[model samples]
Target: MVTIAKANAELWVFPLSGPTGGSGITAVDVIVVDIEDSDGRAGTGFSYVLGGGGATVAAAARDMLERFVAGQETVPPQALWRRLAGSLNRLGRGYGYLAIAAIDVATWDLHAKRLDMPLYSALGGVARTLPVYGSGGFGPTQDPDAAVARSLEYAGMGCTAVKLRVAGAPADLDRIRAVADALPDGVDIMADANEKCDLARAQWLVNALADVNALWLEEPLPAHDTNGFATLAANSPVPIATGEHHQGVVELVPLMQARAVSVVQPDLAMMGGITESLRVAHVAEHYNLVVSPHFLPALFIHVAGAAPSIRWMEDFPLLEPLFDNPVGMDADGNISPPDTPGHGIQWAHGARQEYRIAE
Candidate 1:
């Protein structure tokens, strides 16, 4: 019997835009990997493309695929992750999450494939599909009416909750009130100031939202404003959420240690990948916190399903048409994880005409 063989990688981009913090996702660039053996079967993995900027750390992935991990015999998933992870550490930059993210996820893709089982089942089977909330609304809404209308639309779609943006605009309080007034009872409201609010103003916004029963106040202060985060978290009437900007585990652990956030909201694609998110989850769990991934909800859902403390997945449904068969959403607003081999991502080849190479 032949042992194992080689691996190959891809730099990809899908044409669509997702908006956040005044920016829209004009593309989805990722580094994908395919690993094969002496007998010829293979498994695939991927990472954000140059931080989803059109290059999936391609040069680095090429280095790893060529220098290591390509022709090795199949090993335990954790061991392979460590080996790929270790390479980045030895380089001393630790800016290799693209390398780390691509390999680690692909390794799991391979493991799930080898067993012909969905990733969640391979890990431990699903605990629950978990509740999901509508993530983005009032994003740079030029018209306050349009913004409030959009927020209500999300709630009307049966989302258990909704997140509205406050651009640090002068009438931010009015916008919050407009949105809260639109949402019905039992449908919770959360607000993101995108760090537009300083500690003092964040406190003011939190207090203003309290009358509306806000579920949480997200990133009211700039991300690095730890004292601001602590000040608000310690005293804000609304729960505080953050972590979409943290670079890696080292940074996140300390934040969790300080009780800096009520909810650990890591973006899977941005937080390096499932590997680092799991690390964040452990820290969040140790501190008795909830892990709610920030975006790219389709992939994040699987990771969320695996964490015992995952409170809810982010399922901003507006982006559904961007994918081939968008994730399943229901009348009650529950989001379900697909029982597929990989993350259930399949690009429609020769179907969509807008496809472009992000790199």
Candidate 2:
């Protein structure tokens, strides 16, 4: 049996073009993991922090690798994930999950490469194209006219849907209306509050979004407010979408069970990599809920191939520039997983060298 020979983790930091809406995130910290087996095969995986904490995550990854992964006999990625997570049961789930995420991703990539198949096919999925929504161009403070122009730009690109950030204010309704009025007949609109509202304002915003014929209202309240979500979902006309902030399937199942959320948005790092995120998608399917992952369409398009519940992929291009050949949107505004072995993500020629943080 092949055994893990060595595992290494590195930290890289890249500044965003500007501070993002609501979160005010000005930079992204990437923790990259590379693992090689006794037989000489290698794979790559990564996790990210929105604003800070790269060194902590990288350190955690190193600890986990040295303690659990190195020299261990090869196992299925799912089983390996369970082992690592179970060992950390008492360690609290903050940055540890992000650390596990990078290793889990790398393990999955290695498994796919060993089998001489693309990740989707290795995960028991056929290669298929999935729909994408334009998820940029409008921040919480953006003007309605600019929002309309951005929506039109997405429309020109053949995207059927676009998402804009909302701040749960009275003017949010007018802003949504302006964009809706500008878009063509079939194109849909979605709004993300980014956890900027309390229950009262979230309730108001949901009704307002429904009145404007929006596709959905995302993260209106904080992710932990399950009781509020259940209460609001019971009365809201439009669907509520959340899940990016949640850490694992354990946290998501409660929301799904209560019928609190209609759409589940899993982030790769937040869900601790493809293994748990896939579990979330399958669990969402059982609840008859829709799955639209948070970002990194290049990585998630593979998951979409494996999970029928994933109907939409977000096209917020944050980390795409760091990769040499990320999958691109089709002329029809849909994206598909690459047939190449593994996830097919490679750092650009000098990206690692340029962004690597000195230890």
Candidate 3:
């Protein structure tokens, strides 16, 4: 029987070229959790903080390992996930969930490794190939020509779809026009506002993008604005998608039931690991809403294998910089599940030495 022998957490910060979306992409904070069992097996998981608070997340992760996981006998992953959530009921989905995400993911990785099975197959292996979309085109930094070039770059790579960030201004219509006009034939375009718009602004965008033939508009209103999203959905020429920032399935259910969103996007870290992510996907399937998880296609590829409702896997490459063997897409714009056991993430040589904060 494998029991948790040791667990620790550390912080890794990486600087970006420029601002990404509205988050001001100066640097990213990563909380890394390393777990080991009595038998000497190991697992690693991490969460991303767009701007700051890496210390808090890392501390919380360490606390979780010491308080609940260390010395515990390995058990069914779903049971461990529940125990972890119950242990931190008071935190109410704050930084603690981020910690829970990393630990729970590590537990699953350990479990999959113990069984010598690829995580995708362990998750149920519903599909071998998941379609992908190139994600970029930040506004205020990437001008129309630059955005167009980026879109074409993805298109040239055989990507069927590409998503660009909307500036959420009256002039955004012009930017969309310029990019839309330059897109190659048969390539689909999508827009993301990153919750930068109010109801009126979202409506204006919906109306302005009437002729762009965008596949969808993401987070036009804030994630919590279900009423506004419902209102927009009633009038939108394009489908609406949201939920990356939602705390859990509770926040997402209303949006799906109200027909407020056509696509449901959940970040694994924000959604609290594979257990909850699969739960969300099953719920979306019940409601007939498309599930497209936000970021980390490499990890979410396993979820796609298990959840048939996951329509597309996004190729954001947010964490690729840190991995020596990052997942890649095929010439046909599709990605296959990793054949290796566990999540198949190979950290770059000396990554922890280079990025880990010295204690």
Candidate 4:
């Protein structure tokens, strides 16, 4: 009879060290959710928007808590997720899904804590290490020499793979080639166009990527461009990757079924938390596609433990500064989930006070 006793949501904004690679994202707006049971146990969860929109997301989170979460029994996390999602049938899935994501994560955390088990274990997974790829070294307009230097730094740190941002320009090919040439043998290179290219440009980039023996080309076209992705993938030399902007399983199915994507990268918040994210991973496994979640390896490490398709985790470091003790890449360029109960993420002391925005 452990019922939910209280729930709260807050908005926090953190400025990036600099504009992010490709997207030029300058800040992140995090909506934090906390849920407590009648027995006084508590759990925490969060979702974020890349540039801005903290207030809207936070408000939606609050409304969800009031309408659907309060006074509910501590049922299974998936059950709560379905209820939350069903409530949004008419409201549409845009910001509502983000709001549901925060609540769903909090529910899972509380459920795992109640069982006195780590999140991965609660999800029927054993702790294991997954390969990590270095990301965020090369921006779209960065100098080739600087990009090569950063790639070398990541390689020196034991990264087996590195990702660079690419524009649809001719010079982009040379930039990727330069980085590839500088890296040691056995290390791999990946490129992200951030949905900046058209069909023809994407086709050109994929062929060039193959010439360099690159691993894959991510988001060469907009996420919804299924026709373009299908067309490009059919003729492209390199594997095509996408899914960060495709929302949930509904949006991802077409891309996967069309064989348009060789790798599926699910964003935790965008997928409405771990439950749905795992669903995406399992579906990818069905299609023999690789599952490389977008950013937050510290969090996705848990998902990787359960989902066999997730072989690589991106080390983007977007939200690491907010956590007191985030997981780090090992000497072998891999990261493992913490054995502690729940997700094992703790906010830095005074982080909430420093970043919280008033309503």
Candidate 5:
């Protein structure tokens, strides 16, 4: 059996061209991990923050590797994950899961590479092509024209659907209307409030989107407000979408049980890793809810293969620009898993030199 020989992690910060709407993401925080087995075979994985706290997450990642993962013999991926999760039992959620996600992903990459299989196939080869939705526009600074222009950009790339942000401003509905009107025939629209709205305003936003026939209203209420979501789900004209900030099944089970949302979005970093995210997808399936994981389409493409519940891949390449060879979109506006042996992400030749955070 291949035993883990060494593990190390680093933090990389890349500035975003602009903010990510209400979240105000001015930069991306990337926590990168590298693991090697006795034979010198290696794998890499990473996690990120949108705006801040990257350094803290990076430190947490280093701590996890040095303390819990360094000497552990390579075991089944799930077994190692449980060890890590159990270690974090006392620390609560949030940071612990985010930190472990990078390491867990790195371990999975090693596992897949050692087995000589593509990561997606190793997970469960459902379909090679995962349908994608254009996921930008509606940032804090975007005006109605900019929002429409962004939607058109995604449509130009052959995406069938696009997501926009709704900042709860009085002008949001009008902005949504203008953007929706600008879309070509057959294109669909989705809106995200980025947790910027309360129940009353969320309800209003949902009501206003009726004229646009939006596919879903995402994160209109804070993720913790299960009751608020239930209320909205019960009466709002649009289907509710949330869970990107969720840690794992603990948070998701309640949301599902409460019938909080029709589409459950699991963020890879926040959910721990692919293993936990798959658990979330299975749980979502049990509740007859659809899985539309937030961002990281490259990684989630494999997830789409394993979990039949996932219907759309979000094409928000926030960290992808740092990769030498990121996933690409097919002419059909779908993404296919790389036949490469692991998760198939590599830093661009100068990425580390360019974006690595100085100590």
Candidate 6:
């Protein structure tokens, strides 16, 4: 008989000194939700620890949370979402989704804590595992030697596949060649343009990399350009993947219908949380599309594991250090959902004071 009382956001900016090939991400804020029930047990939810441009998202979440769930019963995720539909006017879809996401995760955490079960087990406990490709820690157009070394390191770390970032068409080809050449025979090499290319250049990159046996090409064009995306999806020699940045399930309905993307990569934080992601997975399933849950590896992994429709899971072996009990990958290349109760992360051993407050 407890009710929700409060919420907050946290940013974890663990500095990476080595720089590596992973681009400009110096830190990430794992958005944390503070919830006080009538019984006095406080539960926290972790959203995507988005670095770089995600600070705005953290700033925008609190107002929405206060208006929606500060004094309500820790209800079903759907009930929380129902409040969202009505309150979304002040907070637009993207930020609104992030706000809802923090609370949804908190609700799931609260539910699991109440039931004394792990999040995965509550979601239909399956002894399921999936193949994971190496992701993160690579960037757009790095030194040729550095790129090759980086790709090889991931392959050596038991990853079945590795992804690299590509930029302009000329640099794109070189990046593909460097990483592709570095991988072992059976390991697949994938590339993401990170919304860097136009349709024609994207087509060129895909066609040019035909010799590399790349598993997929991700976000060559900006995420919103569905027609351009479809054009690339249809023409690219590589399998086209998109959807990490989209905000709602409605946005995905058209993309699925048009076959604009090869992999549907809805992130848990941005795609309206696990509830909405499940809906998107069904839509992708209906269209014969491959659903790849992007980023926030822990949350997305559960969504992927729970849904029968999903095919591949993105792996970020580099991101393990931030969590006190960060989830790990198994021999089959899949991450085992945390066995502990809830979404499964405790603050790391030396977690920064109150979740990495930035200026």
Clashing pairs counted in every model: 7, 0, 1, 0, 1, 4
Best by lDDT: 2
Model 4 C-alpha lDDT per residue in residues 1-359, reported as the tens digit of each score: 88899999999999888788789989999999999999998989999998787799899999989988888888899998898889889988888888878888888888889899999998888897988899966798788899999898888888999999998788897788899899999789999999999999999899899988889999999889999999999999899999999788999999999999999999888889888999999999999999999998888888888899999999888889999888889888889999889998889999999999988
Q: Which 10 residues in a row give candidate 1 its minimum summed lDDT?
A: 350-359
> Candidates' lDDT values, in order?
0.68, 0.91, 0.83, 0.90, 0.86, 0.72
The residue pairs found clashing in candidate 5 are 324-348
Ranked candidates (lDDT, high to low): 2, 4, 5, 3, 6, 1
User: Over the stretch 302-337, how does candidate 3's per-residue lDDT look in tens digits?
Assistant: 888888899898887677889888778999898887
Q: Which segments of model 1 are wrong by more than 4 Å?
A: 1-6, 15-21, 37-42, 49-53, 90-95, 317-322, 351-359
User: Which ten contiguous residues of candidate 5 have the minimum total lDDT?
Assistant: 135-144
After superposition, the stretches of candidate 3 with alpha carbons farther than 4 Å from their true spots are none
- Badly placed stretches (over 4 Å) of model 2 are none
State the lDDT at 15 in candidate 2.
84
Error of 2 at 216 (Å): 0.8
lDDT of 1 by residue, 1-359 (tens): 43357776666655444444444555556666667667555565666642264353766776776776766677756676567667766664243666666766777777777777776766654836666688655574446687677767777778878777776566776777777777788788887777677777777788888888888888888887777787778887888888877766677776677777888888654566677777787678888987778766666667766678777777654334445685665777777778877666554455234543433
For candidate 3, the per-residue lDDT at 97 reads 78
- Candidate 3, lDDT over the whole model: 0.83
lDDT of candidate 6 at residue 320, scale 0 to 100? 56
Error of 4 at 233 (Å): 0.6
lDDT of 6 by residue, 118-156 (tens): 776666645356777777678785777777887777777
What tens-digit string does per-residue lDDT give for candidate 2 at 7-94? 9999999888887655768889999999999999999999999979889999999999998999999899999999888878899788
Better of 1 and 2 by lDDT: 2
Greater-lDDT candidate between 1 and 5: 5
lDDT of 5 by residue, 1-359 (tens): 66789999899988888766568778888899999999888989988876689889989888888887777778867888898899877888778888889998898899889888888777866555877999865574468898888889888898999888886778887778888889999899888888988889888889888778999999998889989999999997788899998897998898899887999999989999988998999989999999899888888898788888888899887878888778878887889888889888888899898888876
Q: Count steric clashes of candidate 2.
A: 0
Instruction: Give the Å shift of residue 59 in candidate 4.
Output: 0.6
Off by over 4 Å in 6: 5-7, 10-23, 48-56, 317-320
lDDT of 6: 0.72
Model 3, clash count? 1
